[model samples]
Target: MSHLAIIPLLLPLFTGIFLLLLREQRIYIKRTISGLSSIALIAVSTQLLCAVSDGNILVYSLSNWPAPFGIVLMADRLAALMVLTTSLLALFSLIYAMSGTDRQGRQFHILFQLQLFGLNGAFLTADLFNLFVFFEVLLLASYSLLLHGGGRKRIRSGLHFVVINVVGSSLFLFAVGILYGILGTLNMADLAVKVAHVSPENIGLVKTAGLLLFVVFALKAALLPLYLWLPTAYSQTSAPAAALFAIMTKVGAYSILRVYSLIFGNEAGPLANLLDGWLLGMALTTIIIGSFGLLGSKRLRQQVAYLVVISAGTLLTGFSLNSQAGIAAGLYYLPHTTFATAALFLLADLIVQRRDQMEDKLEAGLVITKQKFLGVMFFVLAIIASGLPPLSGFLGKFMLLRAALEHPALPYIMAIVLVNGLLTVIAMARTGALFFFAAHAVDTATNTYIKQSEPEPLKVRELLPILSLLGLCVLMTLWAGPINSYSLETANQLLDTPAYIDAVLGKEAQ
Candidate 1:
């Protein structure tokens, strides 16, 4: 009922438009505007989160229109959490870009704001069709961002990224069309009501539509088979873009959780548990593939990119459990992985810049400037990324493992999760040794790495973003109990389909 629900979307929408008009004028001016806007978003999102923390579900009906007829923006705990996470991630990424990456491309700030607009809209939307609209908004902005710093590698990766997403979009439209044609509504709560009462003759089509939507969400989430494009796209993009994209896959995860738990939830009779075992199977395979990918990667960026894949799998594994504890575990793990992996991306960018010509390749290169500083940062981030003890990562995995103990596939899940963690540690250690230790070895025969003068000092500004993200991981670990309790509440709220439908559709409809 409150209007604040729409501010997250409007703020970014207007800012992006304004920045677009001011495009290429004064770089510093654009940075200031973008930075302030990002900060504002964080404030507004934080307020929204606090407002909804007490189990309040605020719905903003556009133009005073009611549900199933007009567009609506709903802010429950899950939506607020997502918006806040996106806001935080965007701000840090923008800060990193201002260090120099923004200068590498035209309209970087404009695209950044637009992507945020899309991301916020996606998280708050109450309609499936609107979800598609938001997806396109974010994807369009990401497309430009991916190619921001033009290069052959980026061009190739962007091409595949575009084609695959275009196909996904097409499938999304087709599914939406089918659902609307049959059910006569695209509003999610309305569809939930209609789906349960679907005519037997049309149940097949309904299920088809539901599964199609899953395919689109899975593609976005980067599930096993559909995730082939992620590593290359993330690795080749500019560092800031990669960091922001850390939350993009979570969008897919959010979609699956939202849609499945609502329209196709336990109340859906035949459609209940539609994604049941399917998600767990795909998630396990995704983790395995991602682990091997991390081990085999020759570049730091690619390794970080694969870590994203592994995180996605881990998240889905918890969500697929279809239990309160499991979903809570996934929600808790979500922010941890996002922040950790994003820190790694930013760290990788710094390493690449300081390595002279060696870039992020795993091979030994010239001794980087501030090797000790960067090395320590890498070591800490590595432990975090690999889910080692005493960090948010370990707590997240521990919570998930405990949750899965009651599930049927406990053995497979436990084995894969444990092995993936081990492989991640090994890969990170190896990469660290090559980049920090091996590179420092003076080729006594040739003294190739021996420099006559010390390299430039590391910039504090450039390090801020990575440190900020890592700091968040530490905070998450420090406040694990309160955070996990909140997650449990959020999960409980999510599974209460009747309440959601009642809120969106009104009590009379229910």
Candidate 2:
């Protein structure tokens, strides 16, 4: 009965609505409102996490309706963690936006809040159909945000993004329709129960629906074949949007983890482990492709985009193991990649801002102001992204590899992951050298180092958000012990299917 589960959804919902009603000219007020709302979101999400930290599954039935009939907002450790991650990222992204990026579009604040609303709701919703609704909400807000600056690159990428997601959304609805028609319930807990006992005649339809859901989630997660739309869309979008999008791919990974484990899990009789065979192979392929993309990228933003793909592939690989340790490793790595990738995007933009004509291209450009500071930041991020020692990325990847030691495909998993890490290291080193070390005078005879003009002085306010994100990565590394312990507990809770079912549908139903 705790209301905390619903607050994460409601706070942003109302905040977005209020921001929409305000006049756009009152820009300062709008920024203040949006910033405060994001801060409040962090607080509320923290409370929700604390509430569920003790193995509690807090479910709030809409309108006091009972299970399987009512729409429910369920906050378990997993959902709470995701909500918190989204909130933290949103706040930092907003701070970065406030540094002039928000001016690039109309109603930036409103759309930002709406996007948070959708993200928070998507994490907390317990019903399958409501999940689709939240997906649309987030996608709608993202379409505008992606094209916020209004340029040819953004438009082209936005159109591709829009078309792909629309098709994915259609697939999601079709899958949901099949599930509801056959199972008579769209509540995930109920579906889990019903899917286990599905009659033989309907098994084919159920399997079809399940595979369709997997495809939709993979498309969202940007798994290979369906990931064609992500690099362009993500790399071309504004920095703040790109940074916020660091968590977007994780949503697909999260859905795959949730739906596959809960509904078609080991207890699903014939449908048990339906996706197990395909997930590992696809995940490895995704990693390989992403590694190649990193080497192939000609720009910093695009390289960062490919890194996101690799992270997703790694995450799903862990989940594919279907073991507690593997899932725990993925959970720990999730936030690390998110923070690190986002920091890189923000930093890339900062570097591009000072390069004048060169932007983020991986070619020699005029040396930027604050070269020393930016160089150090990029170096730290590079180490983290490449999964080098003493960082959260390394620890997370280590745990995953350790967890996979017993799997039949251990060698392949290790090979792909380790090789990807090496490629990432090479890519990062090359990018850093080009941006920081390769700069030379534009006029050799005159020995002119500056661009048409010296780039604008670097501002502390602009660096603050990027630094904050990096600081989070550092803290995550320092606090790995407790964090990993928590991840393990969450993994345990996730694998405890009966507990989840009983909590949602009551012990009688289970």
For all candidates in order, the CA lDDT equals 0.93, 0.91
User: TM-scores across all candidates?
Assistant: 0.98, 0.98
What tens digits encode model 2's per-residue C-alpha lDDT throughout 257-358?
Answer: 999999999889889989978999999999999999999999999999999999999999999999999999999999999999999999999998888778
Q: Residues 250-327, candidate 1: write the lDDT tens digits.
A: 999999999999999999988888998799999999999999999999899999999999999999999999899999
Residue 281's lDDT within candidate 2 is 94
Q: Could you give me the TM-score of model 1 versus the true structure?
A: 0.98
lDDT score, candidate 1, position 473: 96
- Residue 250 displacement (Å), model 2: 0.8
RMSD of 1: 1.3
What residue runs in model 1 are displaced by over 4 Å at the alpha carbon? 441-453
Candidate 2 runs further than 4 Å off: 443-452
Write down the worst ten-residue block by lDDT for model 1. 447-456
